[model samples]
Target chain A: MEELKQAILNKGVVVSNGVLKVDTFLNHQIDPILIAQMGQEFVKRFNGKEITKILTIESSGIAPAFTTALELGIPFVFARKKKSLTLSSNLLSAKVHSFTKNETNEITVSKDFILEDDKILIIDDFLANGEAALGLASLVEQANATVVGIGIVIEKSFQPGREKLEQAGYQVESLARLASLENNTVRFLEEVATK
Target chain B: MEELKQAILNKGVVVSNGVLKVDTFLNHQIDPILIAQMGQEFVKRFNGKEITKILTIESSGIAPAFTTALELGIPFVFARKKKSLTLSSNLLSAKVHSFTKNETNEITVSKDFILEDDKILIIDDFLANGEAALGLASLVEQANATVVGIGIVIEKSFQPGREKLEQAGYQVESLARLASLENNTVRFLEEVATK
Candidate 1:
């Protein structure tokens, strides 16, 4: 987590008031070594939980979820952003509002992937508005699966995402929590918490 | 490779003629254990290549690329299907035609991640039309990076992808090379000499 914070500090760019860009390492261009470590950490965080499957959303959540799935030795199921011809017609759908895109889109997962009596672990790169995570949780519920935990690489604490998820009775754990992004400088709550 | 073949024969779905869907394990719902083994196989296949990075496209390609990158302890850069707010303005772009989607979309990788001197190993889930592979290759070329090898989970031999890529002089390795998929039955080519 410290390494991730340092990487964000060194390379992350604040594009606007709320947008923190860590594309140099986090999402677009992935640091696989760090991602693998993050996956291990997630495994540690949810050590006792029965994580039968990892649920993520494309296209950014794929990397971290992939690594996490490998670490946990579980199957990774990601909700496709678009419905391809290869996908089946029976799917569980949820509406996700993207803060960056400034629009809501329908996210879906095939019914065959997630089954009842399965324990799911949801992973993602960032949790901003919590729309995507909530949407994925919606799909897990549709499958009659239990969401064991929610693991995030980076979380925006100033946003209401964490509170919203907590209110929904989901245990959320984020490696890096951004406390504030003011005047083009990103600050971490963990940094202040440690001091 | 035998394990991969067995996984396909046991779990892969045979769609109509020349179409085999291994989405249950390869793409839609990914088996991370098998993917980890495949990653080791990729490292062995491209053993001597100076691979500085693992290159792939978004969505399905991210999983295998993540595994290979973890195996080699390298970074992975994925080309996005569309530009997002987080994406940088300076990018290497290429047009990719998806056979399943029946549409052509432009994929882009930000110039900041890939360097001119980088030696990239490309990885993907399937090699059907090879448009996605070629698109990633184009991004690497635009970055002035060398594509050391192309690792595919499955290759449809009936498709012209391998021929086209080999003509372009790329060292390609597929886990299972299907000789043909006739009447919804998948068959692999006979064991041949390895390059």
Candidate 2:
């Protein structure tokens, strides 16, 4: 987490009060070395949990989830933002609203992938309003699967995403927590002593 | 690459005459262990190339590219299909037509990521008509970067993707090459005797 925090401070661009652009290394362009470390950290944090699969949203979430799944030796499934023609009709879906894009898109996964007895760990790149995370959880629930926990790369602690997932009775682990992004500066949340 | 070929023959589904769905382990639902091997294979295939970075499109391409970059110890960049609010105006864009979706999307990468003197290796999940690969090449060319070669996880040899890229003078390496998908069966193209 120190490396990630340092990377955020050094390379992360604070575009505005709530927006932090990590395109230089995190999302748009990726640093595989750093990402692999993050994955190891997630595996360590979620140690001893019975995780049958890793679930994530498409695009940004794929990298961290893939690495974590690689470390855990489990398969990871990415929910597609749009249903493609190749996708089968048997799907588990939920409507997710993106606060940044200000649009609602239906994210879906094939029902065949998530089985009834499976334990799913939800992972994503950023968690702001918890819409994407909650949507992923819904998909798992639809298939009668167990929600193991949620793993996040970067969490906007100023936002309600963490609180919402915690309120839903799911454990949330974030590598880098942003306390604030005000005045074109980056601030990280101090680690809670209990965690 | 025998493991990949066996995976395709065993789990790959022929949805139709032209479409072979490996969603079970390749794209929708991903097997990290296998993908890591695919990444290793890519590194072995493109060995000795001066690859400073890995370039790929978003979503499915991110996994293979991420693993390949991890193995090569280089940074990888994925072009965004749609411009988000957080993206800067300084961008390099290219139009890519998805034959499967029957749609064209303008993929963009941040100007800060791709440098003029950088040597890049393009990685993708599948190669069909070569549109996506060519689109990525154009982005590299826009930045005046040198493309080392293109690495594809699966290639439909019957399609024009490899031929087009080869004719365009880019070395194309595909781990699994499909000869045909007729009568709901998967057939791999025989390996060329010479490298």
Instruction: Pick the DockQ winner.
Output: 2
DockQ of each: 0.79, 0.88
Clashing pairs in 1: none
Worst 10 residues of 1 chain A by lDDT: A186-195
lDDT of 1 by residue, A55-129 (tens): 999878887888888887779998987677777698898998897888788888899989998899999889988
Candidate 1's docking class is: medium
Worst 10 residues of 1 chain B by lDDT: B186-195
Model 1 spans > 4 angstroms off: A193-195, B191-195
